[model samples]
Target: MSRHAFFIAGDRVVHVANPCGAGFQYQAQSHVLSPRAQVGPQQHEAAETVLVVQQGALELMVNGAAGYVPAGSFVRIPAKTWFAYRNVGDVAAFVLCRTAPPQPARGARKITIQIAAA
Candidate 1:
């Protein structure tokens, strides 16, 4: 059997696999925030991402609008868009992040044609 690898806390690692042309599939490590732990403006050029809160409440600012994303809530971010989020409560905040192609089939078209008797 092959042994897979994993990391422990304090390592500040990013998991990666299956390199694409210019970028590899990447996942940032999950983090736990203390009361008022915060993150600032950040942007990405790759896939769109979502933040799902698992515990406690979180305040988020995307582009410029402000909103609260609490436990069991998800906030979506468009690719290449600037955004930021922070924990605003007095409890530990947990979040799960996922990235995927936005509008994967937007450029494709669908059509239907009718046949007439001559």
Candidate 2:
């Protein structure tokens, strides 16, 4: 089951159905990153992260192996694997991100004002 959801957080334009709050364990969001932006060589301790480039292109480096993922391409960052992503394209890159076991929220909290359907 899915429900339409929308929110904006930092530089990410998130638009996806997230069932985490309703008690579903896994979480997902469409992350829209700005052009030339780079996400760190971070590692997930518990949940494995799956990222699929929905639009534009992203250079994904997983455990030192790098590959360019264009729209409709996906890469999996296993738990404890170092990974990063950078949008080399001039346009904004959209990535569909899903994490199993629901990753914990970190840093500042942004108010998620739900967008009402018309």
By lDDT, the best candidate is: 2
As for model 2, its CA RMSD to the true structure in angstroms is 9.3
Q: Where does model 1 exceed 4 Å of error? A: 1-24, 101-118
Q: After superposition, how far is residue 33 of candidate 2 from its true place, in Å?
A: 1.6
- Candidate 2, residues 1-118, lDDT tens digits: the string is 1233444444345566665565445666667789999887898788898887778999988889888898877777778889999998999997777776444445424444755444
**Whole-model Cα lDDT of every candidate shown, in order:** 0.65, 0.73
Of candidate 1, the 10-residue stretch with the lowest lDDT total is 1-10
How does each model score on TM-score? 0.62, 0.67
Tens digit of per-residue lDDT, candidate 1, span 21-107: 333243433557788888768887877877767688888988898898878777889889888888898889976666556654454
State residue 44's C-alpha deviation in candidate 2, in Å: 0.9
Query: Can you give the lDDT of residue 68 in candidate 2?
Result: 88
Alpha carbon lDDT at 12, candidate 1: 33
Per-model tally of clashing residue pairs: 0, 0
